[model samples]
Target: MKTLDFWFDTVSPYAYLAFERLPQALEGISYSVRYRPLLFGALLKHWGQLGPAEFEPKRAWTLRQVHWQARELGVELALPAQHPFNPLALQRLALACGDVDGLPNRRVVEALFHHVWRGGGADASDPARLQALQAELRPALDPQGGEVKQRLRALTEEAIALGLFGVPTIAFEGKLFWGLDALPMLRAAMLGDAWFDGPWNEVARPQPGVRRR
Candidate 1:
């Protein structure tokens, strides 16, 4: 079976949508997904770019777009009380639920996503709600421990090393498919479509005519 590394950050509404739609997108494919939760803020800092929510106009556009996309895709999504909230706690908790190889429990992943995306405008970073989630998870590792924190850092570093600048990216066969819209392309690649062997590589060969300062 093929293994796909799914990199996500709960702070992203698109990631939540992708997580919910992934199973249906990959139907009939023999593949296993390894959920890798990382801090979206860290990625933004590392790449020297601001997140959509950090930019005023883009934030508004992103909010509207995600809600519209969710409706079109028939997936449930509700923005939390705050955008760009701290996701460190959730990421650590997800790591604590992992096995020895650090493969997080899919159920726990889903629960965390629901906490953020389906909380009906509740504060995802609220201490009480987080504690409740921790109690519900009964994680194998200590979510508040140093080891979990280090592991989260390691994972974020690994993602950066792999050249990932965004959440909801699926890494398959050394190629990265980014965004919820790329699911169809991922499916095509998984099915070994020959178009990837031709235009996929050829398309990247074009250089930009104008440089932005």
Candidate 2:
């Protein structure tokens, strides 16, 4: 059986959208889904890319699109009061919870998604709320847990190495499909379809010696 790496960041609205539908979308499929918790902030920093919230216009448009897409998909979604809350603890908690290839980790994913996106509290970043979550999940997650933090960092670095620049990316058999919009394409690739056999377009190859300007 093949395994697909699902790289996600808890604070990402798009990730939340994918989280809601991924299971059903993947139903009857032969792939094993492994939920990997990674830091989107770190990726942005590494690539020197601006986050959606850092640019006001894109942020507004993206949020609107998110709502529309959620409704179109019939998935319940709500934006947190804070757009880019700290994701360190969330990632760590996920690591502490163990593998999400099964039921227990699924619940943790849903609960964290709800806590940050659907719930109006926007308290997932609050230390008190984090403690409450840690207590409730009973996952042996210490907010200051060292090993879990390292694990999360390692996963984020692994994502970078895998050529990932965003959340909700699915990596299967060395092929990467990014964003919820790419899910269908990913499914096709997973099913051994011919759509993936040829080049879709041509672009310039990266010149490492030349500076990007």
Candidate 3:
């Protein structure tokens, strides 16, 4: 069986969508997923890029796209009251739910995603709501503890080292399939499709003829 590292940030609508669609996307594949929570803002910073929500026009388009995608995928998704809110607390909470390996269980990950996506335009960072979620989780570790904070940081650093620049990335067989749209390709890769043997590797070798300033 293959192990898929599902790297995500709770702040990403695409991540929530991907999480909801993942099971159906890989129905017959023999693989286990490790839920990894990381800071998406940190990733954007590292890549010297702005998040989709950081730009006005892009933010509008992104919101529309994600909502359309949710409906198409038959998943429930509501944009939070705010876009690109700090996800540090959510990341820490997820790490606090980890057992020895610092990887949260699927249940914990799912609960977090639902908390952010299911509430109808709710404030994801609201203290009262977070308190209720904490009570519900009853995590074995303290979400506010230094250990959990350090773990979150370490995971983000590790993600950067692995060349990950975005959330909802699935790392399998040493290759990364990024975003919700990439799920079909991911499924194809898992099935050992012959196209990956040549075209996949060949596609990356093309040299750019022009440079943007």
lDDT of 2 at 88: 84
Better model by lDDT: candidate 1 vs candidate 2: 1
TM-score, predicted candidate 2 vs. hidden true structure: 0.88
The lDDT values for all models are 0.93, 0.79, 0.92
For candidate 1, the 10 contiguous residues with the lowest summed lDDT are 99-108
- Which candidate has the top score in lDDT? 1
* lDDT for each residue of candidate 3 in 79-168, tens digit (9 for 90 to 100): 999998988888899999897787899999999999899978899999999999999998989999998989889999999999999989
Q: Write the per-residue lDDT of candidate 1 for residues 1-213, one digit (tens) a residue.
A: 999999999999999999999999999999998999999898999988899999899999999999999999998888999997999899999999997688586798999999999998899999999999999988998988988999999999999999999989999999999999999999999999998888988989989999764
Q: What is the lDDT of residue 33 in candidate 3?
A: 92
What are the models' TM-scores? 0.96, 0.88, 0.96
Clash totals, every prediction:
0, 0, 0
Candidate 2: count of backbone clashes, pairs at least 3 residues apart or interchain: 0
- Minimum summed lDDT over a 10-residue window in model 2 is located at 198-207
lDDT of 2 by residue, 38-150 (tens): 99998999999988877889989988998899999998777777777788887778778875432226688888888787776466688787878878787855546787778
Q: Whole-model lDDT, candidate 1?
A: 0.93
Error of 1 at 49 (Å): 0.8
Which predicted model would earn the best TM-score? 3
